[model samples]
Target: MGSIDSYIFRTTLTSFAVVMASLTGVIWITQALRGIDLMTSQGQTILTFLGLTGLAVPVLILVIAPIALMIAVAHTLNRLATDSEIIVMNAAGLSPLRLFRPFVYATLVVSAIVILIGAYIAPDGLRRIARWDSEITADVLANVLQPGRFAQLEQNLTIRVRERQPGGLLVGVFIDDRRDPNDRVSIIADHGTVLKNSEGSFLVLEDGHLERFQAGQQEPALVAFSRYAFDMSKFSRARDVAYGIREHYLWELMWPDPNDPLLKQLPTQFRSEMHDRLLAPIYPFFFAAVTFAFLGLARTTRQSRNFSMIGAVLCAFVVRLAGFALSVIANQTPYVAGLQYLLLVIAIAVSVWLIRRNVVIEPPARLVDALNALTASLSRLVRRPMPA
Candidate 1:
């Protein structure tokens, strides 16, 4: 690679990395806040929240990488054109295809990253997060260990222990089960024990009265019992969740088990998910094609390429949105998979043709004129005096 190639490649790669991380961090924080209730209501620690949220980063990276590469390519090309560096190279007999080689190299690198995250990192992260959430929810000690405070174990269940003895006995146990909309239960016992079995944990309440209230009426029906086994599963249901298509590993998706009931139920959905992951690496280069297709052969004048940049952004947006739609449609109709690949191939072909021809996108003067007229009318409306 020449000095110019090295310079453009390095600058674009750095810009892509920075943009990707910034966008991922911002989106991750927005997503992580949804899990804050785990700590605020469910008595989870700050570290636990961070751990669960951190596991989602690989998924975020998968979504952010291609857009970042496109932005980086467009930004670097615009800067070069504005500084007349591209013109200098053009005068020295550098072809548009030659100028785009560095960006293609960068795209190759970014594509590898996308593939790695889509195939391995994201699925593994999701699996770990599922396990973490299950363990936290099923932990009887964390949910009900406090001696004098009522802990809201989840959305509908609450428990309070007056005292916890040294030998794993709970005294003055109070449990409120409001999970059922039709029947709300309140159980108070002299003492209780927490026991775990193959199915789940159970809170064995001794010498307690069960108060059950119907949905509409407030009056309660009380029944006394020597021993009552209140299934702890009702309080928290963080058991082994049936793994969905999104949660399956790449290999699992590619070679689905026909014996598996979930796979048998929705084969196309699983196949769509697999293809989505497999196609992750291709779109980055396709985006690079669309990006450079707009601004590849730099203009000799000092005129702004704002319109060209907007055109490139719109093109990229349309292609990506179409891909996303195909991903959804492919779940039901697998033939959308062919349409997705076709769309990408068309974009790539047009991009290469434009680069070879050195085509320059011009501003849409009619749209610009319309926008200007609208703004002028708005300005006049704002400045006009009020009627007496």
Candidate 2:
């Protein structure tokens, strides 16, 4: 590639990386917050919590990459136009299509990344997350049987142990169960141990006394036992992992097993997801074309490029929103999926035509004048001095 092409490509790619990271990090933090209970209540280590939450980053990148590419393309085009580089290139016999080549390369790179994540990495991450969650929830002894801390295993149920012995034995165990509205059961045990077998999980308590208090009666019934088995199966989750449509690999989606229970149940969802992943890579190119069509023109500073930038952003937003809407509709009407391809085809065709013809897109005269008037009003309001 020529120096100019390399320069444009580098700048655009750098911008894309920066924007993609910023957006993904911010959104990932918000998503991670929702699962903070992994560390806060589930007794998971910080690294484990972060690793589990970090598995979601690939999916976020799959969604954010296209938007970041669009923004990067817009930034590069606006910079070229602002410095009259586009005009200079035009004067030097560089056609609009030639000037657009660098952006196309950058878009291709981003699209490949999106495709990789969407087709395999993202779904793999989701599946691993499901597996991790199952393992974490099913290991109830590790998560709930802490010494000296009352662990809220579930709503209205609490377990606490004064000490834990070397061999997985719990000492001075206390259980409070108020799940039933009429009866509140409390058990104090001298020692306990968790047992998991083919039947289910159970907390076997030795030398325990059980006290039952009914809502209506002031007196409480008590029972003493040498050995009591408290049902802990409810607190333990099933180890079986069930994956959603989004968790399927691309090949699995493409050539799904007919007997797969989830596919058999939500066949429409499978179809929609397959289409979405297939079309994921094309969006970056579409976004780049749309952005360049609006912001690639060489106009004087007096022309005000703000409206052009806004138009580009709004057009990109509308196109993406339409794609999302169509994807949703495709779940119900299978044929509707074709409309997304048609939409992108038409948009990219129009954008390419406009770029080739050097067509400039501008707002209507009336809208411009109204915006100018509103800006003046706002300026006056800001400049107006406060009364003493």
* Candidate 2's TM-score: 0.81
Per-residue accuracy of model 2 over 1-388 as CA lDDT, tens digit each: 9999999999999999999999999999999999898766556778888999999999999889989998998888878887889889989999888889999999889988988999999999999999988888788777766678898988899999998776678899999999998999999999998898988889999998999999989999999999999999877865789899999999999999989999888999899999999999999989899889888866666787888888888998999999999999999999999999999999999999999999989889999899889999999999999999
Q: Which stretches of model 1 miss by more than 4 angstroms?
A: 140-238, 364-388
> Which candidate ranks first by lDDT, i.e. highest?
2
TM-score of each candidate structure, all chains considered together: 0.76, 0.81
- Residue 332, candidate 1: Cα error in Å is 1.3
lDDT of each: 0.86, 0.90
lDDT of 1 at 305: 74
Q: Which pairs of residues collide in candidate 1?
A: none
> Per-residue error at 136 for model 2, in Å?
0.7
